[model samples]
Target: MGDLEIVKRAIAGDDESFLLVMQVNKEGLYRTAFAFLRNEHDALEAMQEVIYRAYKNMHKVKEPSYVKTWLTRIMMNYCQDQLKKKKRFTINETLNEISIDDGTVQLELQEALKKLSEQEQQLVYMKYFQDTKIKDIAVMENIPEGTVKSRLHKILKTLRQHLTEKGEMDHV
Candidate 1:
């Protein structure tokens, strides 16, 4: 069945249809959750919560085609709330303890990503990590296409500069 059909069925209170929707989008949902939580257990818990919330609020989704984006936005909001709670419970005594030469290129890139604003981080993830198109990202983010492109360009430039200054990327 098409995604729209499945979403319509799910919203109409078909349990199997909702499960199908969850089954189809599980990987994408998990990836987004993991990217934020960075722990397998926490990511799994987040996914469960996202699924429950999606099921409960499935009727609030306006467009069937936008179901994926709607779920993603919910996951992002949930992750952000979890992150805030985590920060409150955790202590960061080694904020300055990271050494430039201590990790691989991927690790350095991850560190640089953490320095970006939440919106920038989400843009980078959607554009690069998830390979989402600019148009799709704009729709998902509820912004104009030109704005998405501009923000992505600026984010890439900032990432490159940050990596280069940290000696993580070779100047070209």
Candidate 2:
């Protein structure tokens, strides 16, 4: 079913519909939250809270079509609150953990991804990691499609430069 139909049923207290909502968007939502929180543990906690909040306050959502944005906004707020509490560094620990199976070049790309600005990182994560369309990202970021395109271009260029400068371009 569509998100709107799912939301309508969820609002009407159909628990299965609510679970369906979770099943459909959980991975995307978790990845988006992870972009902001950076730690899997913290991101999971925030996602759980977001789900609880969304469930409890479903009536407050004004439009059926906006459920995705609404849930994201809730997750964003929860992430911000968690950030304030943590006062974490720019270099999140999650980014530091390297996998041995990935090659050196892949590792370099991972490190380069870690170097991106928070917004740039989010854009890359939303676009590549979560496979979100640029239009949807523009809507979610409250920016124009042109801006999203421009940012992606600039971020990709910068990431390549950073990786090359760091001698990790061979990985790519």
Candidate 3:
């Protein structure tokens, strides 16, 4: 069945349908969670939490077609919450371990991303990392399509400026 039909059945209290939904979206959900959490263990935990929350609030989903977006938003929220809690404890273990040894450009890009607001960061993640469409992002963020496009444009401008200022983009 399609995602919409599966979502409808899941919302109607079909446990198997719910599991199927989770099974189908698990990879995408984990990738999104890992993008935010930057750890396998934390990503797994966030996925579990998102599944629990989505199952509990399945009826709140207004459009079955956007179930993937809804689930992703939930995962993002949970990962953000975990980050906030980690901030309170001043945990350095996870943060220090999530280093990119591939290239300095990636490190510089991450630094630039950190300078963005949470919403901007999310937009970047959804657009680039998850390869989500602008319309889908708009629906997930509860904003208009034009608004999302404008915001994304501004965010890209800001990132480019930040990287240029830091002389990180000179090589490109």
TM-score for model 3? 0.89
Per-residue lDDT value at 113 in model 2: 77
The sequence of per-residue lDDT tens digits that candidate 3 reaches over residues 1-172 is 6778888898788999999989999999999998888889988889878988998998787888888878888887788889889878876665476676737777778778878887788788888887889989887778999999999999989989988988944655
Who is ahead in TM-score, 2 or 3? 3
lDDT (10s digit) by residue, model 1, range 67-98? 77678778878987887787898876223334
lDDT of 2: 0.76
The number of the candidate with the highest lDDT is 3
Question: All candidates' lDDT scores?
Answer: 0.82, 0.76, 0.84
Candidate numbers, best lDDT first, in rank order:
3, 1, 2
**lDDT by residue (tens digit), candidate 2, 42-78:** 8888888989998898877666666776676677667
Rate residue 99 of model 1 by lDDT: 45
Better of 1 and 2 by TM-score: 1
List runs of model 1 lying over 4 Å from the truth. Answer: 92-103, 168-172
TM-score of 1: 0.84
Sum up the clashes in candidate 3. Answer: 0
